[model samples]
Target: MTAVVEQPPAQPKVKAGGGERGLIDLVLRFREAGILGALVVLVAVTTVINPRFLSAQGVEDIFLNASILALLAVGQTLVVVTRNIDLSVGSVVGLVAFVVGDFVSGTQHGVLVAVALGVAIGAACGLVNGLLVSFCGVPALVVTLGTLYVIQGLNHYIAHGEQISAAEVPGAILSLGNGDLLGIPYLPLISVAVMLAVGYYLRSYSSGREFYAIGSSPEAARLAGIPIRRRVLTAYLAAGVLAGLAGTLWLARFGTVVADPARGWELDVVAAVVVGGVAIVGGVGTVYGAALGALLITTIGSVLVVLKINPFWQEAIVGLLLLLAISADRLVALRLARVLRKRNVRHG
Candidate 1:
């Protein structure tokens, strides 16, 4: 008899679309890694130049300064991922800060009440924006730009040229802004928590994925049965909510609010989002990347100051970085498309 029955040949292991996903994820990680590396190099060089830059106080200052901007950037990510923009966020923040400050200072409202008021005001503003853009089919840029001025006008009228002094702010709110748990500042902690939550939601949820789909191709997503309007509305609502929260935090951190607090901050928020890998064209970006981008921008400002560089150069440097980031993003997207096509053909 034969020594043994012939062994059956093994079938090739199947991986489904694992290779494609892996490649896509690798590209995304590469973008984030590049930003992180830049941040490290910048920090290291600046620290070497000024040892004070690495001191505990200096480090805290960096995180503190970046926290609010990072929060705003995270909110902007939601809207940008949906192929929309919220130019009025700065105005919303300014309005909320002043209103909330005035309300809190004159009344006996606690932190919770002040925060709720801020959120409500923000939601109302967001609702107007969502309705206009989603239902009316208005261009987001034009709609938000209009709202920006409207909100600013309202803020100034309400302010009546008045400002909320530090004495007017509540102790609890100030504590929330400045106090720390263990060794970390509350502001940075809150910013990180919000970033992680939004990042997880966008990465893991089906609805979150739909935002990207709509942004990538509205027609395709619509054909696929996604409620594009609702999703867009939700994104705007979220951005408004976060802007409101940021406004509250702004009050806490600064403890003084003028009619035009955070004026011109919208540009910085957009810049951070763009630099963090969120395409201005939409559909591809992560909250994590956006937060890091905010941190990088904040660090750049600090570095310039520490190195005694001209303040005007900070804007120039940010603009240069923004250009480089956009170029990198476009290149990566093209490479990813090519890879996907090759994989599809090979699989077929």
Candidate 2:
């Protein structure tokens, strides 16, 4: 009589689908893994064709070339994650590089003062950009594009067709750029530090997570009590600061600054961000991925030079890769959605 009622079978647990979860995790990582694989293959082939491609000097050159772009890509990632773009970054870099170089060239300012000035200049630009996009309700593309021309004009007027020469750069600043720690170059070290810091913040903080939320669905984010305007403004400010820092580094690395030093580079930055797995559609990407994408872009150019390929083909190859990346991202997203749907229904 006590056992008259049979016990119902227990519902299956979600942990039962561990295999599916693992697979989903792997799929999520496919973008970074694929880019890494491509990089390894490209480097191997280029090194085989010209062993000097992996030589010490060649390696140094590649890192140096990738550093500034990687830094800019990191900043762009912040903005793009929130469904916005900053076309003015290249102009900001150019202006900062010119102004900082000119200031240091004329004054006895040390490296610290020069860097502080550069960062301040960058902050000012970021504030302007943030105010326009956040408060005025202007589209990011329009706002940044307009600022691009304004910054370029200011740079040209300030330059008056003059350029900063190598001799004008201070020894300490040059050391900061070109010096090494235990045989590791400083430029790459700086870039790595920055990428790590930003990456960590984005991964671990609520405020950072809000960026993706806003990008994924603005209305939902707003309903969740997220401050969309503040987040978006912060993104633009971060981008501006990074661009400024990149400008200072540019001067240090090249020891020469022109009014339009970074012209046409905005396209390259966007391309790298896209190829690095940050969706132009927003709400998907990582700084680490963006940095790798920058490296891949920079490496392709070096590989071409090593293989003695025509320089013109460099841009073409980049475009092809961009298209392929976009297609692959689409496929992955579709597959992920299907898998997630199946998992949800099964578990439910």
Model 2 Cα lDDT, one tens digit per residue, 154-220: 9999999999997988888888788899999988999999999999998799888888878867777
Model 2 lowest lDDT segment of ten: 11-20
For candidate 2, give the lDDT of residue 230: 96
Query: Best by lDDT, which number?
Result: 1
**Model 1, C-alpha of 82: deviation from truth (Å):** 1.2
Q: Over the stretch 185-243, how does candidate 1's per-residue lDDT look in tens digits?
A: 99999999999999999888888888888887788788677899999999999999999
lDDT of 1 at 316: 90
Model 1's TM-score against the true structure:
0.92
Which portions of model 2 miss their true places by more than 4 Å?
1-25, 344-348
Q: What is the TM-score of each candidate against the true structure?
A: 0.92, 0.91
TM-score of 2: 0.91
